[model samples]
Target: METATPFKLLLVDDDPQILLGLEKIISSHFSGDEILIFSCKNGLMASQLLASEPINAVITDIKMPLFSGIDLLKFMNEQNLACSSIVLSGYDDFNLVKNAMRLGASDYLLKPVDEGLLINALYELKKQSGQLPSFTRQTYSLTSILKMQQLLEGLIGSSDISLPDADDFEQEHHISGQTSCLMCYVDIRRALYSNYLTMFQFLTDRVESFLNSSREIPLLNPTVVYGRLDTYWIFLLFTDEASFEPEKILEPFLALLTKDHFKYSFTTAWYPYAHIRQADEECRKGFEKYYFDLPYAPSDAPANWQTLSESLDAAAAAAAAYDYASTIKNLELCFAMFNFLSPSISDVRKEMHHFVYSILNRNSAFIPIISTSKFTDYDLFEHIEKSESLSVLKKHLYSSVNYLIGELIESMENKDDYVIQKAKEYIHNNYQDNLTLNDVATHVFLSENYFSTLFSQKTGTTFRNYLRSFRIEKAKELLTTTNLRIYEVAQQTGYNEHSHFVRAFKAITGQSPGDYRQMKK
Candidate 1:
């Protein structure tokens, strides 16, 4: 079954007793994916949460003081909030249910709601009413999505999908081995899907078709998605077929999906597993990052998306002009600005890729992205997005830029191609830390003088001058994007002497650091 999108669920009732019961039940079930649940003793407060938060469903008692549940229902309709509403009523309140139903309440539950009945009612509402939650750009990993689906299936009032012991959870409850289950994770690109549930139905039906065609008895491998997006699937693999690939289903699905409109493309991973319980611990373990990110609030710093965007555009211009220092500086500024937000590390993946894509996107008329990254199969965006912290993100970002620059320096002589590539990778990675020519020369297993000679011969500059230029460009980025003292910028870019740095800055750019910063400003 497709999981409910993370929603704001409001509980409104005058009686604390009923409010407590409903909270307990729903909290036990249907609350996750960062779902926010709020309870208020009156409609007045519930209405406020509805206004302030992204509420998708509301459960309200029919009669209450000040503002009654009926009044709340009427307000929802008047405002065109169109949220799914379940009315709670007494045995004597069927007359009120008549009014609530007329007012477009989804369904009514009697006082002291039965757990199974409430679940079944909500399930039917999702199916019949077509009131599934909407999508947020937030993307969860495939493992996280599946683990969440398992939790919704297992629990009644729990927020966590993880088990204390995977072995124990599996032992206590396990899928039978007789059923050939295949766990498939599908990544939905932004362009390929619009509504979540419809795409889900399409994939599930496709999987069932394969199962139905199976020569095995009782052969329909029931297919379902675990999350709101058709991102993860648990289905049966057919043994009768010589080979079974979900690609058969996906091929047709892709045919119908417009490729040009695709905002993001995804890879699919399928595995044959005997039982979910067998390796579920690993699945939950992989999802720990998602769980860790639950407490996230967007960075408090005001977003300057336009400024960050413009910097990347400038970096592209610099790259096209062979201003390696300026290109690196501009791109580094983009990463540095990213830190001000202090966003959840997992959330930054998409944003980081966006910036890297901005640079690579310019490769056609400028530096070719393939020649820069293809030799190493460096999926810079993927690596950067998966980083677990700001420090790592910065590290990945610079390494990618350096790799591109190193590749751009592909020599016609070819003698220093390998040596220069290795050297550039080292400098890009270690520039912000402690880096030296000896460190790089040792890394390439060449003597300092020999490596230095080859580098100079290929680039027409001594290694020292090139390294200095690279650091100065990097320092220029920090000068513009950060408020660090000039000395700090110098130190960060592998310069120690303040006077020496000043002279070098003036020598290369014909201006002091302060002057350069003003010019950029």
Candidate 2:
């Protein structure tokens, strides 16, 4: 039978009773494990011992003489020591607790600590440390390991995958005896897909730095793996044991990532202890759910599968039936909702992309058209940088939304339905020449009658009537804004016959062009 490897531990406390108590508790609870309990009356002695010898983890009293736990943490961080740390403290030391956390203590427990809580903390330390052992070993190349570690860290930050399979990983790397937890799935909105690779690489580096400084887990065994699948990125976290709520670990990390780096929000799906073989499929489901279910603004962190599934189903239904006009209205509403959330521009962009893509992907044809357009390729950062004010950003978003909707409509197969667009384009390009509904319909490859019906359906007016209204609106503008004569206005507004223009203008505006101009004057 294979012997269970004993976990190495180091305990530091000024009081003899506390040291003896921890020793007894650890020995009794973890009978098969190796326990190294060091009694130090002060932080100075503990620091000397730490410098001289290797230790897997440390449990220290906060108020030790000459050197405090915070001081020790600073010293360890400066020395770049790789040891998990927990603080043992008395109640009513709120300031100390806060300072210790700032100094990088993984967790703090009050005096007379519950045995279970102590054990759990130790287990968590072991799990975190066990998941990341390469950071400590001498045989691994630091640069290559660092790169891999960075990728794993990004996966942890972006998705809900908890630790990779430590046993299999250890065997491959020739490092033995490690345990890990689950994998996380991270889905960035497809509109942001172009930035996914670079952004993830940057995020991965930051996350690794964070995890490296974390005293709660060991860095020697990286527990996370960041993988890419099409437009989404996946993160797998490996750990010795799964304890504490997984999201509790992930949500704050994502919040920190969004706050510190990108202005975008990230959605994660967590699979605790997911078998390696099933990870890809499980992650796909998670990615689909996240992409489809993201809210208009960041909400409370999601906790379970049921809510995620429900949200996705509702969003999919909305996408399937969404109209461009309705989408514009919703886009404005979503902008308002984002302001209410007070999220950074990146977060807002993430939500916006998810919402837009969910709607756009409803039609398969819409995807290819939008994918090939400049509107879909616009960079949020570039837009934000160029915007003079929030109002400008709002205008930019609205314009892009309108453009995307127009493109989708343009890609439809109904030539008759496109008469209005053809008419508008034609009139825009050839307003100085003779132009009419017949000319526009023929240009758009539509017969007069069918084009009239489709144009009316599209523009809510017959082609001839619509042209008359459009030309008259332009004539009124030129009448007031320019010193052009009535005939010149008619010619500029697409009517060659002056009398016909006057009659048509009067029929629509209930006033001759001269009367309208005088009224404005």
Candidate 3:
């Protein structure tokens, strides 16, 4: 096996400060390695460097002035530079990141980038270049998350888990808990699933800032950021009394969210778990209501035309975010708004027709509730009016909208399945080469992280594990049939180092290659 060339990294950002900050953070991780790091203010300079220098990877910002990151990505593709790219994206720039992903960006890191994340991206690019992976802060973060989630979830039984002693809780939880605690779970509406880390940090800062300024509200201790899953934030609030109601914290939180004008709709609920014995009950019983109970109060009286229209519009926007939960929840709010009007069955039916039509306009291809041409006529409304009761009308409307959600999910699934299958085919046809996950992900036009996740979801095995299994299987067939040295067999099956191949083979097969070969003979 040959040692790989030293890694060369190109950093491009319109902001000089950002470029310097990112380079300083990333370079610290590779101080002992033979790696070259270069920084430029725009993509044009990065492009020039790409043409003249041996750059193994690039970290570029998306919204540069003269030569944007997207433009640079396009140039890289057209000229086939083959450098792995990591796009620096903002929350609003997700659409652009999607386009960049399709244009072969290896992965993306969000703006106000975390130091660990930058190092992790560079370390990952290094691995894809056939170099040994190094320990990175990103690695530590991921490892810590796994350990924390495991310990926290394990401390409580599936049935019981809310309260532990303050001393033990503070020690085990890694933070101080208020004598009275409110555990608030917040789910952001319309946040991209891939932006988990950024969302976590953003929510953390937002909540902390609000807590800091709002002292008038009876809060004993500062808000503590609890652990997070992919897109949700779990926060804990402390109060002076053990019998404190969670709504005290939740109400103020909601008020602050409204005041701040957050773009995403959020569902927030807090559980009171101050009593040690009731901890399990609070967590287990309240979880259902927390997730499914209507976040907004139900209405019976007539809602104004403006309010109904606004609710419907909000639901439509939720659909665009691909937030099916929020869409349905908003639709439920809309239905409540409609029923509050105490309008005639005919009036409700009329409004339903308009609402459904609005939703279908965006998803007409996925939901076939009506023909595109038929949307102009009143025939669909007449059919809907035939429903005998409000109960029946609500059921009909719910099922239909659910079908739309199902269709939307399925449409995306089909496209994802096609991409994963293509990737699998590519891996199969080229298993003998020194292939990297980035190469396959790049070939299939997906960000490496997304490709890995989608592939695992579809196949129930990770890309690396799947590739290793395939390669080892190929090596087995060759060892049995052909007169080849073990090292040659290892190379043909994509292992660059003989010892690494032997270790992997034994791990998978429970036998050395030589022993397996002798047994076959």
Candidate 4:
């Protein structure tokens, strides 16, 4: 491969992890001789590098502690450095993105950047800087997750994985004569299948992209595989660079993940590389110790966490029973415990999200009502993640729960009203025939007992009384309008016996049919 024309790129961010991540990706793409990359923790340091070094391009963040990315752009503009500038910012910083564009930034990208876009932008910048040669796009493709999973599991069971592709896999992904390896396992507390799928793919892609471009590990492509539920395992075979810190490389990418998906609690443990099986055992042991026996939990942590956990369960139970007040109270208690304990923000969000999941699982009918036609679970989860304090999280939680409960109650009332209206229509049309509470209830698709109680509650009268009153009114109309005899009138009004009909008419109107007909006529 011909050596590409020497190009210089400067990456600027206040975060060291950000700088490290960018450097690794860029270096993986261009050799040290082909593209020289410089990094700094702040805009001031970046400005110093630009002054001393003949930098051809610069990618900078918009916000920093003291001197912002905007200030760095101003310095570049004033100095008239012939450098291609690109700015990065969060979506909230759109105004700053525009300001960067106004200040002669050639392009801008949102934070949690798409690596493909970054690569393309760099390519364009390289072309503009007069690249006269070519570089190799050397990469390792993880063709099958299933195959990789089988190979790793096989390696765990025995000393050597005796698969047909073992030799080719070693040649493609492993460093030759590697004495040591670095292994990292990441676990995210996302319960839903859809959510875990997204998080897993995201972390996998980022690690793969970086490793694919990395030149140090030519012997082995890092092994990236799905571990147990909601976790990922990554193994890198590196040359004897004992000074190399894997945390420095991995932390930045994790930081990027948290920036975008703060609602999820992500835990990672590092292990010394031996063989695949040994490394797996070490990673699991370390992860369990780090996750379950965390130092942040004080001596009183068990009491507090247990209380919060119990409160979450209680809240879910209350919600399932449609006890809105109890559900809200228990939910508030959980948040209060979180406030007192002051657990990690990520853990708090994850637990609260799980509480919501529990409630929905128990009462799935409310799930659609909660998420659809309003602020969805995804939208509310974002709010929970971005909340600055426990109180803010409580506020968002209360809002979502309130909306869900309110809609549920209102829907129940509407359903009752509809059923009653249908029952009334059925009664009015069929009063001349024999009517029963069971018949009306069946017509409206409700149990007979429930319909009977609902009718009384809605109409302020028992079903039998309402039916009798309807029949009497029809009989009165017939006694006055038609010359029907008392017996004929009783038959027309759904009464089989004349004496019974006359007695009911007198009880209701204080007049027998004979006298009432005479008075009306």
Candidate 5:
């Protein structure tokens, strides 16, 4: 007798209350041990759980923040994850429900969900659970594509490390010796919303599914390698038993990718298979021709790109130091280099994003204010992407830089004023003590020299003068309010010597202490 498979159901909604209620309703129908229940507040969480766990079904809301239920369904479809989906939608989201269905959602329920209908859907999903494919999450030692590329490049550069034979990879893909091979390079312009790894995985699965199902070519699975700049290098190996043209496969593959016309633009280059590493090198050179080298690419493009990167780095450092002039100068230099290079539009957008991200990351004070002012990192990148030309991007960058610098200056001033106010309060409360600038500066966590300069800037008076004037004001108040002896008043007002107090008081009020007392009376 075969063991029964444990049914795992995931409930996804942005509403905590809805998730709890759904869990309760599902729990009432099935025992906890027999049917495992999981809950998440967004589609992102659901996708993660579905990827790692054996989730039999997902009950996800059609709309949510960050990642929508439709996006989750698409992710499952893209990853070829074997889980049934039942989407929850509002009455107005019929179109979204239709999209979810198209993306392999088994069923859907309207909001204020009917418990009976949900139970029915679960029962149907449970019956078909055994048919769902088992999934093992692919593990990677390093998740970042850039890091992986760097590591591979380093290994390739090292004298001791040896590159693997082409036959080795071909044998791993189950193709024998001297097999015909075609290397396909697919470059997609990365979207602002998706991370590189997720995009790469989706493309990989989509390509594998398409190529694996082809009937014309006696094909082994393609050896997929992640490449630089949102590109994939796929090596398709064919058995010696077949005679097929590479274009037959390449043309349809390109067509399949071009279907995502809005989110991605496809640039593909194919070549006869050579050494694995050499194939990548050739593909990169070919891709550079298509992706980076534009009609306007001049002879000095490499030098210009180098200068642009260095200038952006200098600008980031200048921004961190709050040197607005140097920051602007370096940024203008970057723009000049960038325009002179006249790289591809994608390169322009990508470089500007790095420029903005670098500056903001270095000067973190600009991040929150810029974010609150509706110029978030996402918005910034979107603006750069949408710019028709370098001039438009330059204008946007300058406007944003100016706004952030203004905010940074105002923020510094306000903070300094606050610290100065605190210092004033401390002096007012402890004026009778012999408080020096060092003592008060330490209390406020600032160096004495900096505090002195800031005090003068914010209060419009020197620290020593401000203290003397404050003490004198206190003394004059006491001279009229209480008839204490002059020496006693001096002692109470942060002054040790009576003669010095009298001199300071005359300097400020233009009268001797005794005369000031009489004048006030």
Candidate 6:
């Protein structure tokens, strides 16, 4: 068996006895690797020492004489250090613990820490740090996050980023295992960028601290990844298959944030375990569901992310099938309904931004034509607050939706026929269950035979052929891209019989399901 890398430890305290005590306890409890202990009376000395040496982990006292632990934490943040930190303080220093957490300390222990607790914290940190052989005292900077944000901004109007190809992401990210959930939060109002940044920083700080403090449930430290588009943040938490309930862990933190800070309201969405690399796509789906399909008000009840997702998926498909005039008319009704149902401009804006972002992000036909310039310009709340006439607001809503629909139509004209677009939409809406071309044609008010002929004429394929192609495409996606079994794929893509699915798979690709798996290998 191969031995894991040793963790480099840095113990900081003003008192020699306390430092010696920690050294003794850590030496006895953790003997597999070398422990580097740094005795510093103040934060300034610790900062200087950190500047000169590599410290994997830092254990410091909160109430040191000169430079305090909080002061060192601020320095760490400014310096772009990634080392995990533990704060050692008196029991009465609850406020200090909060401050340390806000500054990104991984965990904190009371003075005269228990031997077991100290060892547990160290062990947890070791697991999180991965292959880091030693702890390096370093500074933390927001440069990487800023760079990622910039990259996201660049994707705002690009077509290639549409709905993100899950297979492409798996190949790029090199993800090999299952992920428990994909979590995401989006700030609809662009003006709140600064506030969003602060909230994100706070969330990262608190989550890191919480994970470091707990030894029983070891979780993979989450990373900030780009999502379907540039407007959201994604985190992929790899948890045990049997022990995942991400909502339970996330709710308290969300509640604290909403209650403590009254300036802005927040909405959250989550997707259950799927492929780890498809995290961005799942998060995008979550954002669309929460922001578009669900009600905007904060509720005591948890949002049903799966239901919202299904609804939005259906709505998007329906919207895509409308003729130019019908499309405009439907959007008008949607906006009118929105105007009547939503109580405030803030709520309306949130809903509209979500709806528009989701539709624009998923449909490549709409993105290039919709003016990115105006998406951020209008303040719906300002209009709602100033105008008393419902007529004016209704008109504004109509125009906004109309503009979006027009952009969609214009983009689609160059890429696909109207019937083909409608057929694509139908496939998307019914992809999860048993569906047939005749069923789709009936829904669209066309004769089964006539619709099939038209679909084949417009799309260069028979309706049944198209349905098979679509199902096969989705099945191929599950096979190469997800861990879901062949039977599950069959069920998910509308085929009920496992043997039927296998025969169809072989007929289309000239390979058995097992053979396809081996080919992928």
Residue 286 shift from truth in candidate 3, angstroms: 20
lDDT of 6 by residue, 98-193 (tens): 899898887777665656457656766776777434444222346755654544433222334433444444445443345345444443222122
Better of 2 and 4 by lDDT: 4
The full ranking of all candidates by lDDT, starting with the best, is 4, 5, 3, 1, 2, 6
Look at candidate 6 and tell me the lDDT of residue 293: 31
lDDT of 6 at 329: 43
lDDT of 1 by residue, 326-375 (tens): 87777666665655544555555666555555655644532356444543
Across 1-521, the per-residue lDDT of candidate 5 in tens digits comes to 88666688888999999999998888887887568888999989888888888887888998899999989989998999878888887644768877888898877776667564566567657767653344454533334655545534432232345445433444566644344445555544322111345445545555666665665655444444333333343434344433556556555565655553212222133333333345455554554333231223234334566777887888876665556678888877776666666677677778777876787887587678767766453255656765544554555566666667766767774677657756876787688999999989997899999999999888888999999999999899999999799999999999999899989998999999899888777
TM-score of each: 0.28, 0.28, 0.32, 0.33, 0.33, 0.33
Model 3 regions more than 4 Å off: 1-4, 133-521
RMSD of each: 22.6, 22.0, 27.5, 18.4, 18.9, 27.6
Give me the runs in candidate 5 sitting further than 4 Å from their true place. Answer: 1-179, 185-205, 212-214, 217-235, 238-245, 261-274, 285-341, 344-521
lDDT digits (tens) for residues 1-521 of candidate 4: 86555788889998888888888877767788878888888999999988998999999999997888999999999999999899987645768888998998888766655564566567767877777435443333345555655655543435464565545555565534444455555544321222233334545655656555554533323454333222444444334343445555455555654443322222133333344456665554453222222223223334477878998998987775556688887876676566556666668778877887787787786777756735554245666655545544565566666666667767775778757756876787688787788999999899999989999999999999898898999998998899888899899888988888988899889999899999987
Write the residue-wise lDDT of candidate 3 on 359-388 in tens digits. Answer: 667545534534532333223353365544
Instruction: For residues 1-521, write the lDDT of model 2, one tens digit per residue.
Output: 97655566677778888888988887775654445455576788888988998877888888877888888888889998888788887633668877877877877776765564576566557667663243332233435545555444433334555446434455564432234344554443221211234345444554566455554743344455554444444555556554544555565455544443222222233333333444455545442222222234424534333343344334433333434454444444444444444445455455545554665665465465555654333333344444423444556555554555566566667644445554666655565577666787787787877777777777786766766677787788899899988898988887778899999999998998889999999
Sorted by TM-score (best first), the order is: 4, 6, 5, 3, 2, 1
